[model samples]
Target: MRPQHRVSARIYSVSLRCAASLALALLVSLGCSDEARPKAGAYCKISEEGQASACLAPAQHAYPAFFRGLAQDKLSDEQAREVETDIAQGAQSERSYEALSTLAYGYYRLARAASSQGTADPETLARLEHWNELLSKAYASSEKDPRYREALRQAAVDVGSRTPPLGLRCTDADGKPARCDSTEAVVRAMDEARDQTGVRGEIGRLFDRVFGTRP
Candidate 1:
């Protein structure tokens, strides 16, 4: 072979080896990540035949888009309400912890946005109360699932870091508006709910065992 051709062949061989090494590394990295990821439970899984229930479809398709819209501030009130209705319907039927948590977080985002505007409307206050109720339900439904618990905890921390509006209000048990007033109070409630034990926790575990659902 000519010297130039020999040199070119050697360079090509080196490039091929480097490419192979990188591909191998990438595969190994991906394998590790997959192993580390939490396994999807029955409620969160689509059948191999690509079938999904009405309750599961919105969670798979609309939940992520809705949250993305919230992050980008591109979601209109009507769109948000529509997504909320879809998720709420799914949560009612499926009782999936993931769906419950997603719905709770959406409410929190809406409440935060309304609070940030410096005035808490009646609708916003209602949503805030619903958010708390949903948070409790989500945490309870998580059962022994570490992934669900972690997601709830992280969301609480993220929202709790923000200062609440000075006049933030939430409905009391009597359906009267009461000053909630602080993010700290909200986070404290979330923490307590997440760590709840005794009858409530036992009931949640029993429900999960019966339904075979995971977030």
Candidate 2:
């Protein structure tokens, strides 16, 4: 009877081992499944150059990753140049509101970085103007997007605090060219344009809440 009991125990142990092996195999198969793989057009599947070249494509959804990579200092000089070229092309082509606003943001960041070091260079001044121009275009294209309005307000505030003035431009409700010369003025204008009650405005607000606003 003891011998039979020992044989039964052995069989149970063997069954447990088999079950464990099967479970491991299943996990491995799932890990290597097609669903687990990056798609053919996935951002990670593209080379750095390829990613930069295609950065402006609306379908690529590459800006977030590309800018994140840039912030991490992951891109080489050549790759950075490619990305810059793509941004310029996008701006020139009036590709989309996203592209235009992204270009504006790039210039804004560059100008701010340079200004933080010391007196701004001629290049930095030019970049700030470009930022203003691109941002205007973006805002015109997507007037309902809160981000662009917020950007304009923030830039006005930032410039207001600086010496020698940024000389940024905006249009009044009457379509007259108005100078974005003060934080109060810009914020007031932006407030007038605010529309968080509508579906589009609500969606924009929701996105800002989820994303916590761009840097």
Each candidate: how many clashes?
0, 0
Q: What is the TM-score of each candidate against the true structure?
A: 0.42, 0.32
Error of 1 at 31 (Å): 17
How do the residues 51-115 of candidate 1 rate in per-residue lDDT, one tens digit apiece? 33354554646466665665753454564555445334432334344454445445445656776
Question: Tens digits of per-residue lDDT for model 2 on 1-215?
Answer: 69999999999999999999999999888778744432232111122222233433542353555465445423333433433444344223333334443443344345445546665565545545544544344344445434434544444444444323444455666768766532334434444444446775675566457656422
For model 1, the run of ten residues with the poorest summed lDDT: 42-51
**Clash list (residue pairs), candidate 1:** none
Q: What is the lDDT of residue 58 in candidate 1?
A: 49
C-alpha lDDT of all candidate models, in order: 0.52, 0.46
What is model 2's C-alpha RMSD?
13.9
lDDT of 2 at 128: 50
Can you tell me which runs of candidate 1 are displaced by over 4 Å?
A: 1-61, 64-116, 166-178, 182-186, 193-215
